[model samples]
Target: MARILAEISRTFGEYLLLPNLTDERCTPGNIDLSAPLVRHRVGELAPIRVATPLVSAIMGAVSSVELAIALAQAGGISFIHQNQPISEQAGMVAAVKRHKAGFRHNDVNIKPSATLDEADTLFKRTGSDVIVVTDDGNPSGTFLGLITTQDFNFIRHRRDEVVDSRMRTARELVTGAEGMSLAEANSLLWDSRQDVLPVVSADGRVTALVHRRDEALHHKFSNETVDAAKRFRVGAGVNTHDYLERIPALVEAGADVLCLDSSDGYSVWQQNVLAFVRKEYGDAVRIGAGNVVDGRGFRFLADAGADFVKVGIGGGSICITRDQKGIGRGQASALAEVVAERDAYAEETGMYVPLCSDGGIIHDSHMAIALAFGADFLMLGRYFARFDESPTNKVKLAGQVVKEYWGEGSSRARNVARYGQGKDLAFEEGVDGYVPYAGSLYDNVTVTLAKLRSTMISCGAISLRQFHDTARLVQVSQQTFVQNSEEVQRNERPTVA
Candidate 1:
């Protein structure tokens, strides 16, 4: 007789979320969705925190700077994709970091000698209401004066008037030193009752501008994700083939986190890449790595200094790794197993590495399910792909607006340009597809989060940790599963035609 072993695994579809006993004291609005979803170590230092547990996957051209900025403002993070050139990718990261704040380092500037027509052109190009008048028209140029929408309104005569003729010269402007803190700069603006404050270096070069309106906007969002510089936080992805060249540019471009992106994370190539990065970058930056589906793989990356472990292998809507290569795991099982391992590892060595569930979430309820299974956060591709902010163009499909979506392994995704032909592939692990157009990414996220909060309230859990601790899973009959799915969708706002 031969010995036999039993095996079992679970997927999100195989079970139904069991609600906890309702707490009459709890209400939907009372549920606290705020928590550090990602607590990953940066370099050789303590862990840094990302505000929310929701993340947008780096889906080639679909993950643009606009999407990243939107996600950041909504209390989540987006990984700027690596399919493009390093400069372009870095520029995307740069744009997100520059999107908003009290002090905008990249505000539009104009040379005093430039004509009003030139000023009009610059205003249109940058979409700025105010332009700083500088000696060289650079952010670091010597401060000359300031021009505002009010200044432009005064231009009733020739549109060709020079900026210097109408700009309020330095003598008439309130200025602060470049090294002043945001609070100090803000106070100067308040005391002087000015809407803008020009920050100048010791030699009188304009280094940055502080806007009262920006400060007001910053304080309006109590949960905005920001870096140490108080700029909005963002992440970017890198491949092993270009980590050296790409990492530096991303870091210089103000990337708050970098993930080692790959279809597989257990190979020697990824290990070597980790070693090289640890040696070169030390602990100066936080690094996230994975796409691993087992505890062994998680432990391997953990020992090699992975701060954030991306869980799930073939669960993405576009991924076909399991069907094509016969290598993958059920996302629920993978998340639970790895999270248990993380707890064990934390017990053994006093380090708790956060795990990100990289796929298999189809509905807002699935997000709650993932969190119940101990996923520190959830990462999505198709969900975010359907949004207007995604880089793909909207087209009419059967009389309905739709957007193109695909996986990294898909030829269309790797082509580097829309409508361009892709090269021959050794193997195909993903398919090119499209998603029904969702209006604003922000509005969609808002609705999704609303459902999540409502679900938490119904489950008697107030926070993510509480949900993890109290929530349970219950398997349901195939009929019941169908009914539950339909119920959720029926309650959901219409998404597709």
Candidate 2:
């Protein structure tokens, strides 16, 4: 006999938060968005905590090396997608780990002997206007000279002219040593009135370049997510089939955390994966698991030693699992049940496993609502895919700029291991699509975080923990939901045109 739950499935759209009485101390500035990223005892701190409650999803289109670096600088983390080969994925993780604040170590470079035509091609490939002329044509090669678009005009210079002909030689440039602090480098850059300062090793190899603009940009992110070594924090996704090979590579590459990327994670395969991770790493590594929708599923993963449990199924903007397989739950109902079970488990076992609201975050307000529902953090795919940093290309669609966004289960991704449907996908559970271009991750995330903080302040909460404990919600009827929107529309309607 099949058992059906009594509660009606509900979505975030049907619920609204009721504003609480604001206190003098409940200001937006006082709100702390930090949350634990892993499981821990009630009285102690988790081994990992993110400054912000947002994490980019583990999708090929959303989480890439560039996106990971950008998100980490904005106080969040990104799980580099596992759709590519293990080595490629590992390299992406290594790239983020190698990133230094206010410094560019992987800037475009070319050999001095290369032609201006070759330099132009390199510039277009990297989307950089400036290129370094190195002895070996690599970023770490012996410092030679610097070339910018300003150094030559296509109409004025011949195509075959060598880069060294027009470049500013090392002798003419002001340089910093490898061990110089970012502040010290900035001072030198400003003092020398140079737009760029190359940091060179004792042997005259270029180690990094400090750009004048990056110093200002770096100051805006006071809460950057970084490891003990001060390098940016990054996560990597792994599938069940290749965990044996993938896990070792990612860990060796300095990935801060790992997540099991599966569409459905309440199966024996997930348990086996968790068991293997525990047996081999012995808590030295932090790995999260799941895309489960209910309390039973949450308990299963929690008991299996998942550092954190991911919640939600068939609720992603690109996912169609519910329509295809008829296996899904509403985002709100799923969060409600899983949160209750998480609390109960904490009371019984004294271990508090964090819950991550994985998908269905269509709006910024949804983030506040998820927090009220006790989600320790959020995993966003579409929200991140719209940013310039995402791996996919941006295209002009219907006269509007948009970025490509696709699900792992879509034909475009064909991530069979994530779906666990065998060696290849039997059917599509996701869609390929586009999202409106939302500009830089920093600018968009700034607005989103502002809205979230204001929401928390309106609810009289000064921290995520306080918001979780004190927030109130009301389920709106269909009529009330319509009326709520109509009121705003009515107010904005053009007067008697």
Candidate 3:
């Protein structure tokens, strides 16, 4: 006799689950949310470690350097979109990597002979508070002197004055050597009693700059995510087809993690690409592969040496894969099955692959639901797209402010020159759409995290690990669901006079 598997599937909205167990010993304030949401090696051979589980999905053009910086500061990682020319995408990655650090290697440099008008233009353009005055206006040029905002403020009315006249010469500024450590640099700045310390080479070329206040600010952020260079850790997406050309450029540009972006991960193209990356960069780069739904798919990727696996196929808000192709699985069911497989795979192979739930999150509470179902972290496009930092601008739609959002498989996304395949798309797996504008990313993440913490408290689980082990789902009647929705609406609606 042959065994038959059940044909049942579940999704996030189909039922409600509550934890039956509670430990009075645990409190919400004491809950440690700092566990490694995702653990993978940076390069081919490094030891595994944790990163914030909340990841930003690769939304082309809409994935901005500012958004990446904001997420890294909040202890999460953002994937810079790869739909443009290699250089443009790489530039965005480099910008995020260089944004904030103990030392900024790419700090702005100005020519000593340049005028305040020129410096003002540079300041307005680059947002740098200090500019190093060099012989040739490059970091490798001979160091001449430096100019700070105070220099400009003093000469505010002298709009036509040359930089050399107002700038403080190098002799007056505290200087450090090129190879000095951050601690030594800090000590030098403190001992010299200077706000800015420039590090220069033996031949007098500028190497890097250290700010006493920036160093102080860095120490205050206990949850910041950074790479070996102490730059905010960031990831980028590359399709299986062009990864051969895209991967090298991205890695060189300081991408901390690389995701294999495909609508389907079980195809030969994905496997070939994954194998090629592992072969070429073995253990040198961390790679994640996905869009899988079941145990077999997860097992295949795991065996193929993927550092992490993404779960979800057609569960995205704009995706039509399930409707058009009828070849996708419900996110809830898919995540459950895959999570079990991940646990089993770890037991069998002793290598744990972190799972990322890729899409279909709408409400803040859904984030908690996904984690309870065993997602190590949630990858969001729609949620992140609503923030002011998204690359798209807001427009008024029906009296409400909204931002443009589109899926990678939509015509708007696929018709780009770099990603254009020459042949017309047979059918779109995604659609272009809009989402209501949300405020700053900081406020949004803070509110969501607060709600998540509240959910954890209600579940009596102090950490995601505990929730994964102890949480259970319970089916509720349609009436109960309707009542809850009505209650929320009533609370949100304004009362009539």
CA RMSD, predictions in order: 6.4, 2.8, 5.4
What does candidate 2's lDDT look like per residue over 30-82, in tens digits?
Answer: 88999999999998988889888999999999998878888988889999999
Question: Which numbered prediction scores highest in TM-score against the true structure?
Answer: 2
Which window of 10 residues has the lowest lDDT sum in candidate 3?
41-50
What TM-score, over all chains together, does every model reach?
Answer: 0.75, 0.93, 0.77
Candidate 2 residue-wise lDDT at 189:
99
Please give the TM-score that candidate 2 achieves against the real structure.
Answer: 0.93
Candidate 3, residue 287: Cα displacement in angstroms equals 1.1
Q: Pick the lDDT winner.
A: 2
lDDT of 3 by residue, 1-497 (tens): 97656966677876676756566846756565554433343222224233346889888735688678768877778899877788898998988887545676645888887889889888765546789999999877899998877787633447777889988899998899978888999999999998888888999987778888656545533466777667788888887766888999999998888887876776566678779988999878888888799999999888887778899989889888888788788788899999999999877776778898998687887888898889988899999899877888678999999989998888888833222345676678789989899977777887787787777877888877788888887766788878887744345777799
Instruction: Please identify which of the two predictions, 2 or 3, would achieve the higher TM-score against the true structure.
Output: 2
Note the residue pairs that clash in candidate 1: 43-283, 44-283
lDDT of each: 0.78, 0.90, 0.78
Q: lDDT score, residue 97, model 3?
A: 86
In model 1, what lDDT does residue 90 have? 96
Better candidate number, 2 or 3, judged by lDDT: 2
